[model samples]
Target chain A: MIAAGLDPIAQFELHKIQELKLGPIDISFTNSSLMMVFTVALIGLWLLLSTRKAALVPGRAQSIAEMSYEFIADMIRSTAGKDGLRFFPFVFSLFIFILFANLLGMIPFFFTTTSHIIVTFTFAMMVIGLVVVYGVWKNGFGFLKLFWPAGVPAVLKILLVTPLEIISFLSRPISLSVRLWANMFAGHILLKLFAGFMIMMVSAFGVFKGGLAALIPFSLTLALTPLEFLVAFVQAYVFALLTCVYLSDALHPGHH
Target chain B: MTYLFDMFGYGFAAAASAAETVADYKGDQDGGAAFPPFDPTYFPSQIFWLLVTFFVLYFMLSRIFLPRIGSMIEERSNRIADDLDMASRLQLQAEQAQSSYEQELADARAKAHNIGATTRASVEAEIAKDVEAADVEADRQQAGADARIATIRNQALKNIDKVAADVAAEIVEKIGGFTPNTATVKTAVG
Candidate 1:
C-alpha cells in the first residue's frame, strides 16, 4: 500500500460555499453540509414517489422503499423489542441518511458526510441525548437502576460494578460515533491511495513499460470496491442497531 | 492517542471537541491547510444541516410513509383470508351435492328391484296354470283309447268260438253219421 502525493486525506477537507459568521462562530455551509442536504432530499424523493400509490403488490421502486423501511423497522423490533417502536421514525431516518451518505460518498468526487467526526458525533450525541431525556422523564429514580443490576451482590454493586456500568453507559456515544467515523475515514483513504497508486504506476512507466505493473494496483482498487460497499452497509447497520439498543435502555431501564 | 481520551471516559462532547484539534495528514496537498474534517470550524454548518434534514425526514416518514406501507400489507393479508374462506365454503357445497346425488341413485335402484320382483311372481303364476290344463287334456285322451281296445278284444273272442264250434259239428256228422247240438260243441271248444 504505497501512498504518495495528492494527499489522500484532502478529499475530506471542507470549503465554504457561502460563509456566514455570527459573533465568533463560522456557521458557513460546506461540502459536508451540502452532502447531508442532498442525502435527505434523495430520501424524501424516493420515499414519497415510491409510496405515492403504496400498492399492495409493490413495484420495484416501492419494493426498495418498503424494504428499507422494514429493514430499520425490524432492527428496532428485534433489538429494542416491540415497545421500542416509538423511536422507529428517528432510527429509520438516521439509518437512511447515514446509509445514503456512505453509499453516495463512493462516487468519484462526492463528499462522505459520516466520515467527519463532528458530524457522526452529533448524531451520537442526539441518540445519547434522547436516552438521557427519555430515561429520566420516564424512569426517574429507576434510571439510575441502569447502572445497578438486580442480581449483583450489594457490596459488589456499590464497590465495583456500578462504576463499571456507569462508564459503559457513558461510553456508548463515543464508541458508536468513533467506530463509524474511523472506519469510513480509513477505508476512503485506502481506496484513494490505491487509486493514486495505479495512476502513478501507469504514468511513471509508459503503457508499454508499466502495462503489466499497473494492473496490480488497478486490481487492488477493483477488489477493494466491493469490500468498501460491504463496510458501508455493515457500519450503517451497526450504528442503527446500537441506537436501538440504547433506546431500549431508555424504554426499560435496568432490564438488561 | 485520542482513542485513549475516548477510553478514559472524557464523555462524548469533550472527546468530540478534543478530536477537532488533532492535525490529520496535512502533507502539503493544498498548501498544508488544516484537514477540514478534524478542524472545528465547519462543525456548526454540518450540525445545522443535519438537524434540519433529520427533522424533516423523521416527520415525513412517521406521518405519511410508514402508515401507507402498513395498510398495503394489511390489505393483502385480508384479501388472502377472504379467498381462503370462499374456497372452503365452495368445498362444503360440493360435498353436499355429492351426498344428495348418491342418495337419489340408491333410491332409484331400490325401486327398480321392487318392480322386477312383482313382475316375476305374476309371470310364474301364469306358467303354472298353462301346465295344469295340458295335463288334464292328456289324461282324457288316454282313457278313451283304453275303452275302444277292450270292446274290440271281446268281438275277436266271440268270432273264434263260432268258427271252432261249426267245424266240430261237421266233423262229428261225417265220422258217426250223427249231428251233435251246436251249443254243446261250442261249450266243449271254449
Candidate 2:
C-alpha cells in the first residue's frame, strides 16, 4: 500500500479527535472542525490587532485591514447598491472566512475546510436562505415578480419564462457551492496527482533515468502551485461577488 | 516505444491502487463504501461544528471586527476630507493676501509717481518767477542811470558858454581903455 502521504484522497479523510454522540448522531470534533476554528480565530485576531490603533494615518496592518473593509464595502455598494450596505457584516464574514480557509489549506498537511462540499454548501444555502427571507420580508408578493419578468407575453411567461426562472433560482445554491468546492478540490488534487506522478516516475525508473523523467511532472507541479493560489483567491472573490448579486435581487426584485 | 507503453501502464496501475485504497478506507467505516465528501456518517458532526464556528465567526465579525475596521476607514476618510478642506481654504487666503499686497504696491507706486510730477512742476514754476523778477529789476536800474548822465551833460554845456562870454568882455576893457555899454556886452554874449 502506498503511504497515505502520497494519497491525494487521504488529505480529505476525517478522523475523530473527540468523539461525542447525541442520541443516534455522531458530532465528534474532527480535523475539519479544527481548521474551521483556526480560520475564525485567525480572522478575529487579525482584525482585532490591526485596528487596535485605528489611527487616521493607518499603519501597515491597519491599511491592509481598511483595504479589505473598503473592498467588500465597495463590492456591495456597487453590486447591491447603497441599501445593500446593511449586509456588510454578513458578506464580510463569508468573504474573510472563505479567503482565510482557502489560503490556510494551501499550507502542507493543513486540512482545507472549504474543500468540503458540505461546508461550501452550507454557506451557499445560507446565502440563498437570506435572499428568500429578505426578499419576502422586503417585497412580499412583489418578490414573485423576480420569476415573472416584465415585457414577456402572458402565455410565454406562464409556459416558459417563469418555470425557467424558478429552476434557475433553485439552482443558485447548488452552483455557488459546487463552483467553490470543485475549484479547491480539483486544484489540490491536481497538485497532489502531479507530485505523485513525479514520485512514481523516480521510483519506477532508477533515480538516474527516473529523476530525468520526474522533472516534467516536477516542473508542472511547480507551475500549478502559483495557479492554485490564484484560484484560491479568485474562488473566494467569485463567491462573495455572487453573494452580493443574489442579495441584490432580494433588495430589488424584478428590476433587472 | 515499449518504454512509453510501460510508463502508461504504470500510471494506470497507480491510479487503480489509489482507488482501491480509497475503497478500503471507506469500507473500514460502519456504512457501505461511499466517497468521503458524500459520506453521511460525518454529516451531523460537520453540520454541528460548522454551525458553531460560523456563528462564532459571524458574531465576532459583525459585532466586533467589522465595526472597528469600518469606523477606522470612515474616520480616515473623514480626516482626509477635512484636511483637504483646510488646505483649499488656506490656499484661498494666501491668494487673497497676495492680491492685496499687489494692490498696495500698485497704489504706492502711483502715489510716488504723482508726488514726483507735482514736485517737478512746482520747482519749475518757482525758477521761472525768479528769472522774470531779476529781468525787470535790471531794466529799471539802467533807465535811472541814463537819466542822471543826460542831466549832468546839460549843466556842463551851459557853464562853458557863460565862461566864454566873460573872457571876451575882459579883453575889450583892457585894450580900448573905455567902458562899453553893459546892454551891448550882454547882447553880444547872448
Candidate 3:
C-alpha cells in the first residue's frame, strides 16, 4: 500500500510516461486515453439521463440539468453575444465534463485527470485552435487585423504593440492549462498534507492529548474540504469563461 | 527528471513481470521501457463534449425554440397596447357623456328656476286683484245694510207716535163726556 505523506510530486511523476512507442495504429487504450473515454461517456450519460423527461416543472435532477444548461448558455451569451449562441453547446459540454472530472477527484482513490499539465494543455490547445479557425472562417483574412489596432503611431506599433499582441495571444494556452492544473494539484496536495497532519498528531499524542491535538487539524481539513470543492467548481468556471472570451475575440476579430 | 525515474521504478518492475506473464500484450516490448510512454497528444474529454453541446444548443435555439418565444412576447405586447387604447377611448367617451348630462341638468335647473319665478309673480298679481275685488264687494254690501236699517227705524218711530196720539184723544173724550169722532186712517200717516 502506498504510504500516507508520500511526496505529491512523486505521485504525479508516477503517472507520467517517459517515452512513447508505435504499435497497431488501430486501438490501444492508455490511462489518459481511458480517462478521455470515461469523460465522454460521463457527459453523454449525464445529458441523456438529465434530459430524458425535461419537465416543465423541473424535478430535482431536471432542475440541476436546466441550471447547468442555463449557466453555460448565459455565460456564452453574455461573453460572446447572441452570435455566440452557436457556441453554447460546445461551451456547455466543456463545462460539464470539467466540472464532473473535478468533482470525481473528491472521491477517495479516484484519479483527478485535470491535475496533469498535458491534459490541461491539450484542452487549451483545442480551444485556442477552435478560436483561430472560427475567427478566420467568420471574418476571413481580416482576422489578422485583430493583432493591430487602428489609429496607432506607425513607429510605436512595431516596437511596443506587435510584441504585446503576440505575447497576449500566446499566453492563452499557458494561462488556461496552468490555471486548471495548478488549482487541482495544489488543492489535492493541501488536503493530503492536512490529513497527514491530523493522523500524525492523533498517533503521536495518544488518545487524550493526541486526540485533542488531532481535532485542530481535523477541523481544518474539514473546513478546507468544502473550500476545495469550491475551488474545483471555480476552476471549471474559469476554464469555461476564458474559453468564451477567446471565442469572442474570434467571433469579433476587429474588436479589442 | 530524477524524481520521475524514482517514481517509475516500481511501475517498471510491475510492468516487466506482467509482460513475461502476458505475451499477447506485446506493444511495449519494443521500447526499452516495459510500459507505454506518456503521450500528451490525446485530446481531453472537454473538447468532444464542448463541440457536441454547442451544436445541439445552437440547433435547438436557432431553429425551434427562440422564435416561438419571441413571437409570443410580441403578441402579448400588442394585445396590451390595444387594450390600453380601448380603455382610453372608453374613458374619453364616458367623460364627454358625463359633461353633456351635467350641462343638460344645469340647463333644466335654470329653466325650473325661471318658471318658478314667473309663476310666483303671476300668483302675487292674481292675489292682489282678488283682494281688491273682495274689499269693494264688502263695501257695497255694508252700504245696502245701513240703508235698510235706517228706513226700519224711521217707520217704527212714526207708528209709535200715531198710537200715542190716539190714546190721548180717547182720554180727552171721556173727561169732557162727549162722543169721540173716529176716522179710518194709517197710524203712521197720522
- Candidate achieving the largest DockQ: 2
TM-score of each: 0.73, 0.77, 0.57
Q: Residues B136-157, candidate 3, lDDT per residue (tens digit)?
A: 9888998898888888888888
TM-score of chain B of 1: 0.44
For model 2, the chain A TM-score is 0.96
Give DockQ: model 1: 0.26
Q: For model 1 chain A, where is the 10-residue window of minimal lDDT?
A: A1-10
- The fnat of each candidate, in order, is 0.63, 0.61, 0.02
Q: Could you report the Cα RMSD, in angstroms, for every candidate shown?
A: 7.8, 7.0, 11.9
- Identify the CAPRI category of the predicted complex in candidate 3: incorrect
In model 2, residue pairs whose N, Cα or C atoms come closer than 3 Å (at least 3 residues apart or on different chains), thus clashing, are: none
For model 1, residues B34-86, the per-residue Cα lDDT tens digits are 56667776777888878877888788878887777767767778988988999
TM-scores of chain B alone in all candidate structures, in the order given: 0.44, 0.56, 0.39
Show where candidate 1 strays beyond 4 Å: A1-5, A21-24, B1-32, B96-190
Error of 3 at A255 (Å): 0.9
List model 2 lDDT by residue over A72-177, tens digit each: 9999999999999999999998999999999999998999988788899999999999999999999999999999999999999999999999999999999788
Please state the error at residue A69 of candidate 1 in Å. 2.4
Per-residue lDDT value at A244 in model 2 = 99
